[model samples]
Target: MKTERPRVAIQGIRASFHEEAALRYFGENIETVECNSFKQTFEALQNKEADYVVMAIENSIAGSILPNYSLMMSYSFPVVGEVYVPIQLHLMALPGVRFDDVKYVTSHPIAIRQCIDFFDEYPRLQIVESNDTAACAKRIRDEQLTDTVAIANALAAQLYGLDVLERRIESNKLNFTRFLILTTHENARKKTGANKASLCFQVNNEVGALAKVLNIFAHENVNMSKIQSMPVLGKRNEYNFYVDIEWGETRQFDNAIKQILKYTHNFNILGEYLKYEEDTQAPKPAPSPESTKRYITVRKIE
Candidate 1:
C-alpha cells in the first residue's frame, strides 16, 4: 500500500499563484487543499485538513498583506520555509474567442491593478473583481462565456484550455511574491543552518525603547531585512512590531534575541527558517524611488 501524499493548503483554486508557489516548495507530488481565503487556509491547518500551507506574505507590486500578519499572530503557526515565485499576468479567454469579443474581464483586484497599462488601451472593457485569478478563468471556461476573460497566469490558460488574449499584461515585468510555508508548532522545527528569523514584540511606551532593541541587533551585526509596525487595538499610540532578520553568525543572532527580550514586552519568536535564495527566479534590482516617480507620473497621464 502507498502512503498518503502531504496535503498542502493554498488560498486559491488550481493554477493560481498560490498553487504555483506550493508546487515550487513541495514539488508536484503533494495533494492540494484549496481554501477560499487566507483565514480558511489557516483553519484547514488548524483542523488538520492539511499538513502544510503555502501563503503569500508579500508581493513586489502590492507590498505586504497586512491581514495575514494579524492571522499569524492569532493562530501562532510556525513558518517552516519560504518560496519566492515570479508573477506573470496574462489575459486569457475561452477557446476561439476573439479579443473584440471580450466585453468584460474578471480577476483578483490586484491582478487587474497590475495590468493597468494594458487596460488603458481598451477603455470599454469592464473590469470585475473576483476572489481568485484562476477561479475567474475556471468560471469563464465552465460558463462558456466568450464575452468574458480572466487576467491570470499562463498556468491558468493551460489548465482551462483558454487562449491567451494578451501576454505579460502587467505594468511591472519584474514582479514576484514571497510565500511562507506554515505548519503546526509541533512540526515546525527549524532546520540546521537556518539563517533567518521572524519576530514580533511590543515595546514599553518609553523614550528610546524601540531604538534600544534595534541597537542590540546592530551591535550583534544582525541584518534587519524588514520591519513593520501594526497598531495595537484598544490602545492609543501603541503598536506591535514585526521584524525579519538575517544573520551570518548564529551566536550573534541568538545573543541579540536574548538582549532584545529585556527591552520588549510580549516578545515572541514567530519562526526561524532557511532564507529563499533561488537565483533562477530571483528578481532584477528595482529602480530607485526617484527614478520611478517619473514613470508613475507618465502612467497617470496615459
Candidate 2:
C-alpha cells in the first residue's frame, strides 16, 4: 500500500493567503512548503522540489502582478488550476497596545494600497514594505515593538500572537486575490469539458488588424471571457494580446487557432484551465461573476 500526498510550493510565509489557496487545492493537512519570492516558487517547480506552485497574479484592488506574468509567459509550466481567495486585511500590533501607540505599519505593497483608506486616517503614520504580511506580523511580535503594527490577514495575526487593532481594513468590502496553480509537466492540462483557452500573439498594426484577430474566435463560436493587451519587449510598435476563450470539449477550437497562426506573429498557447467555484454556492460550466482572469506578467529577459 502507498500513501499519496500533495507537495505544494507557495510564495509567502506559512500563514499567508497563498498557503490557504494551496490548501484549498491540495487539502488542509497538505505537505506545504514556502518560498520567499515568486521567482523562487517557479524555480522550486523547475527544480522538481514541488509538484505545484501557487502565487497571487492579481488583486481586485491593485491590478495585475506584472513580474509574475513575465515568468508565466517565458516559463513553460502549464497552469493546472486556479483559486480565488477573498482577502480580509487586518492591522495587528503587540498585545495590550492601543492604536495610538502605532507609529509605523508594514505589509506587502498591494496590501498597503488595499488598506490605504485606513492609513490615510492616520496621516502621521509611516508605511514600510515587506514581502509577506504574515512575516511582518511575526517580526513585529518577535521584536516586541508596541509602536509598530502590521497589515495582514487575521490568521497571520493569530500565528504571530498579536492583537488585532483593526480588521477588514481594505477599501473594498468585496476584495479578493486570484492565484494560479502551475505544474512542471507541459502536457498536464485541464481535462474538464468547460475549459478556458489562453493564447497570446502579436498582430500587425494595419487597418482593422485587431478586429481581424478577434474575428477568428467570433467565427469559431468560442465565447471570449477576457482579453488584455501588453507591449512586446524589445520590439517597437509590436504588442501581444492575451485572450481567454470559453469552450467545451465538443466545440472545435483548433480551427480558430489555425486561422490565428496564419496571421499572428510569435503566437503562443498559455493553457486550457478548468474554471470552478461560482458564487460560493455551485460550480457550473457557464461564466461566473468572479471568473474573469487577467494574470500574465511580462518582464525583460535577463
Candidate 3:
C-alpha cells in the first residue's frame, strides 16, 4: 500500500519561504496548507487539518520573530526539527517589462525591509507592503501589471512565471531564515539522534534566581545555545525565559532539567530535536558585474 503524504501547514502561499522550508524538512511529497498568518498555521494544526507545521522562528537580518515565541507557548507544539534557508530576494516583473518601466514595487513587509538599501537608492519608485512576497508576485502576473514589480525569491518568480529583473537585491548577502518543524503532541515523537531541546520557564524576581538556573545547566555540561526573555502578561517585572540547549549525552540534559526545576516555576519542555547546522565555510560567489552595474545605475535613477 502506498503511504499518504503528510499535510503540512505554512504561514504563506505556495512558492513562499515557508513552503521552501517545509520542502527542505519533509521533502517535496508533502501537501502544503497555506495560511495567511502565523496564528492560522497553529489553528490548522490544532484542528487536525495538517499533520505538521513549518514556521519561521528567526531571521539573520531581522532578528527573532517575537510573536512566534508566544505562539509556540500558547499552542505548545513539539518542534520535531529545524531548517535554515538562505534568503535571496529578487525583483521580478511581468514578461517583456523593462526596469525603467517599473513605477511601484511591492512585497511582504519583511522582504521590503531586507531590501531597504536597494530601495533607498531609488526614491522615485513607490514601495508598497503586501501580505506575502509570493502573493505580490502572483498578483503582478494575475493582473498583468507591467508597471509593478515584486520583491520575492527566485522560486516565486519561477512559479508565477515572472521574469527576474534584479537578482540578490537584499542588502545583506548573508541573510538566512531559520524555520521550526512543529506538530501536535499526539504526532510528535522524539527524533532519533536528538541533541538539542527548547525550554521555557519563569524564575522568581529575586536576585541570583535566574543565575542559579543557568548555573545548573552549566554544571551539567549542557551548552546553552540561545536564551530569550519575554514579558509575562499582566505581570510587573516578571519575565518568561526561553532557552535552547545542546548536549552530547541525554543524561546531562535530564539531570540539568531536574536541578533547574527547583529554581523555576511553570517550567515547560517545548521540544527536543536534532539541531540543524549550516556549512559556514562554504565560499560564496561574488556579485555579477551586470548586477553591480544595475545597482550603480539604479542609484542614479532619482
What tens-digit string does per-residue lDDT give for candidate 3 at 84-111?
8899999999999998978999998989
| TM-scores for all predictions | 0.90, 0.84, 0.90
Candidate 3, residue 285: Cα displacement in angstroms equals 17
Q: Please list the residue runs of candidate 3 whose C-alpha ends up more than 4 Å from where it truly belongs after superposition.
A: 1-3, 279-302
Candidate 2 TM-score, true structure as reference: 0.84
Between candidates 2 and 3, the TM-score winner: 3
TM-score, cand. 1: 0.90
Number of residue pairs clashing in candidate 2, backbone atoms closer than 3 angstroms, sequence gap of 3 or more or interchain = 4
lDDT of each: 0.84, 0.73, 0.84
What tens-digit string does per-residue lDDT give for candidate 1 at 37-70? 8988888889787878899989988999999999
Question: What residue runs in model 1 are displaced by over 4 Å at the alpha carbon?
Answer: 1-3, 280-302
Q: In model 1, which residue pairs have backbone atoms overlapping below 3 Å? A: none
lDDT of 2: 0.73
